[model samples]
Structures are given as C-alpha cells and as structure tokens.
Target: MSRYAILLGAFAVAVMVAGGPSFSQEPGQKGPLVVIVNISNPINQLSAEELEKIYLGKRGFWEWGKPIKMVDLVEEDMNENKSARAIFSAMYMDKSLPALKSYWIRAIFSGKGQPPLVFGRREDVVNYVSQNMEAIGYVRMGELGADNVKSIKILMDNKP
Candidate 1:
C-alpha cells in the first residue's frame, strides 16, 4: 500500500468513524503521554515519522531484521484511547479520523498496512510491552516507571 494510504488510514479510522479524538481531559491533568518499549530493546528513541510508519505497518522490520511489534489502545468512551488519539493526531498521522478509516478499510481488504495489536486497557499495553523486546506502545507519563517498560523519547517533528 502507498505510504499516504497507510497514514490516511491510521488517524482517519480512529477519527472519522469513531467521532474523532476524545476532547475530555483527565481529571486535574492534561493527559501527558510517553512512548514505552521493553527495556531489552536496544534503540532509545524514534522519529515521529518512524513511529507513524511502524504503527501503520509501513515499516515491517527493524534494522536487525527483527519485526517491530506494535501495540495500541482499543477505542472506547474513556480518556486513555482518547488521549492517545489526540496525541497521535497532533504529533503523528495528522489526518482527519474519517479519512484514516476509509483508507484502512480498503487497505486491509487489499492485504496491505495492518494496524497494531490493540489492547482494551493501558495496563494490557504495558504488560505486552514489558514481555516483548520488539514491542512498542505508549501510556500516560506516570505509568512509565511503575512497569518493566522503559520510556523512549519521541523526537517531536523529527527535530534533533
């Protein structure tokens, strides 16, 4: 699938068909997030575009040929998925949700650009990331040190 097709699908699916990112704020917080990887993974950071590529299944393998395992929050009425959607929208895909979905529907049926494995809760994402060296996911900033996962700095706008 085309790179544009993949991106259009990512942010678009979560946005348009699902009513878009959740606008509600976490109580007394702005829903800050941090990307996490299993402590065993050697890489320490990722460009925003690299993340978008992995999550969109555009980059299928790491430099060492290890598959990049991706994780994500399942869509819901709660803030976790919402906050993720907001951050992903603002920092990554940058496409409207509806457009993202429409692209994916066709892409999937065509056997291209699969999305990440989705967990219903953040704890599940953390658990998955902790156990899999190739895993990558994000959580509320405070959830980082509480688990076996390590935070990976996301280079905002791919800046140095």
Candidate 2:
C-alpha cells in the first residue's frame, strides 16, 4: 500500500489520532511523531495505567520485571515538535510536560527511581535505544529504520 494509505489505515485503526499534517501524504509530508521500543521487549504489552506509570515515573519498572530504562526525545528542538508530543501522549495517558515532571519528582523523592534520559533530538533517542537493549524511546516513524531501532505499535493509532 502507499505510505498515505498505510498512515490513514493506521489512524483509522489506532485508538488515538495525534496532531499532525494528514498521514495520507508522502512519508516526509506527515508531521506525526513516532514512538519506538526494542523489538525484543516483552514487558510493555500493558494496560494504559501501567504504561502511564512507567512513562510518568509512578511505576519504577516493568511489571514483574526489573527496572527498564525509559527515554524521551526533548521538544525544545524543531524536529521534536507536535509530532513528538502526539506520539508520547498516545503511548502513555495524559500528554503534559509539567505532569510528567511532577511525576518524576515524586518518583525521585519516593526513592522509586529516576526518569528516563532526555535527548535534544529524535536521532539521539534512537541512538540511545539502539545502543542499549533495555532502553525504550520514541521518534518519528517515518524516520525509523531497521539498523538502529524498531518501531512498536503506539498503544493506539494516530492519524487524520
């Protein structure tokens, strides 16, 4: 199928459609961000609450598993714009930075654990995940490849 078709289909099937130019365009034409994780990871097929806990730092590790490193691509840069936010929000629950920070602070004070590393760019997240098998992060799906990291289903779909 055409890339547009794939994106439209993804949006239709996905539970949440993030903000972006319509995914029905060429690969680069779409502005939606992509979320990713190690293809080998087995702990993430979790409920939205569990995923939120992991991403929000409310929960320190994978369920019944050791602490797994969580990573995020910073939004300060131009590339990690609405697309990134859209993808991040879809993966977890609420999509607010302050909420995330508050959760992180709570985690740190509670001695649960630290928040995932933050990178200045999307490529940085990919590189970090690529180098570490235990790392999990997100990026623009269009920019993804097989060499560095692999894309995981967004818990929900984002399109339209």
Candidate 3:
C-alpha cells in the first residue's frame, strides 16, 4: 500500500478509538444514547414514553414482576451539550438537567419516589447493569464494551 493509504488507515483507527465504535441507528432513534439492560432481563425494547416513566420513577417493576433498578450517569458538566446524560434526558425524559434534578427533589421531598442510582463513569454503569438482573441504564452508543448487558431499542412516535 502507498504511504498515503497507510496514513489514512491510521487516522481512521485513531478516530474510531477516540470516538468509540460506530453504530447504525434505527428510525426514530435520536442521538448516540443507547439504553441498556441486564442480559437476564426479558425486555428487548421500550417505547420512549415507557422509558420516560421508568426514569422518572413512575414505573417500578418489569412486566414479569422483577423490580426495575434504574441507573443514570452523573452530570459531568452542565455546559457539555453532548454528554450522555444531556442527550438521554432530552431524548427520553424530555427534561433539562436542572429541571430533572428539580423533579427528583420534589419527588423525594413529597415521599413519592427517588431518581435512579447515578454513576460517574460509563464503565461503572455498564458494570452495574451487568451485575444486577433487573438493572437498566443508558450509555453512549459506542461506549458499551463487551459486557453481560444488552442494548434495547427505543421506539419513538415519528409523527410530526
């Protein structure tokens, strides 16, 4: 191969390594956020509304009676628009970070519910989900490494 070709190949690999794996998104899927669940969980997909309910503490159990354990990423930087938490909040919960925090605060104060467990790193989130049979969480599409967890499709209404 020519030197130019070798250089280009190296660049491509660098980019992929820096950005994580490439994923082909499905229709109605928005952004790079991927919802993941423990491999033992029977759920294979979730509608956007259902995801919202689960994250917002409205849904507590899977249909088969297993208690739903939700996990979330820590807000690393409020100004980072592309952070996993921001994309997830916008896509699933339809709430900004501050708004979501406020919602959780009120929920906790009123004795209604609590937010999902939060972790600082995506690897930790993946590990937690893999270890807990009922756990569910979201991570950047390319960051889910080889783990005992599965990414479920999120069905969204496409109506304009």
Expressed as tens digits, the lDDT of each residue in 50-110 for candidate 3 is: 9988999999999989889999976454343455676678667777778888999999999
Tens digits of per-residue lDDT for model 1, 1-160: 9999999889777786777554456664346778899998888989988887786678988787899998876535655445565556545666545556676687799999776787866788899999998888887767664457899888876732
Of the pair 1 and 2, which is ahead by TM-score? Answer: 1
Candidate 1: residue 73 Cα off by (Å) = 1.4
Model 3 residue 115 CA deviation (Å) reads 0.6
lDDT of 1 at 55: 69
In terms of TM-score, how similar is model 2 to the real structure? 0.62
Global lDDT of each candidate? 0.74, 0.62, 0.81
Task: Report the C-alpha displacement of residue 150, candidate 1, in angstroms.
Answer: 0.7
The lowest-lDDT stretch of 10 consecutive residues in candidate 2 is 20-29
Ten-residue stretch with the least lDDT total in model 1? 21-30
For residue 49, what is the lDDT in candidate 2?
64
Model 2 lDDT tens row, 1-160 = 7999999888776744554322233334345555566666654444556556667666765554666788877656344324465346644656555556776688799987787788866767877787776777777657666585776554433321
Off by over 4 Å in 1: 1-24, 28-30, 79-81, 145-147
Count steric clashes of candidate 3.
Answer: 0
Query: Which residue pairs clash in candidate 3?
Result: none
Please report, as a residue range, the 10-residue window in candidate 3 with the lowest summed lDDT. Answer: 20-29
Residue pairs of candidate 1 with colliding backbone atoms: 8-100, 9-100, 12-97, 12-100, 12-101, 13-100, 13-101, 15-97, 16-97, 16-98
Measured with C-alpha atoms, the lDDT of residue 150 in candidate 2 is: 73
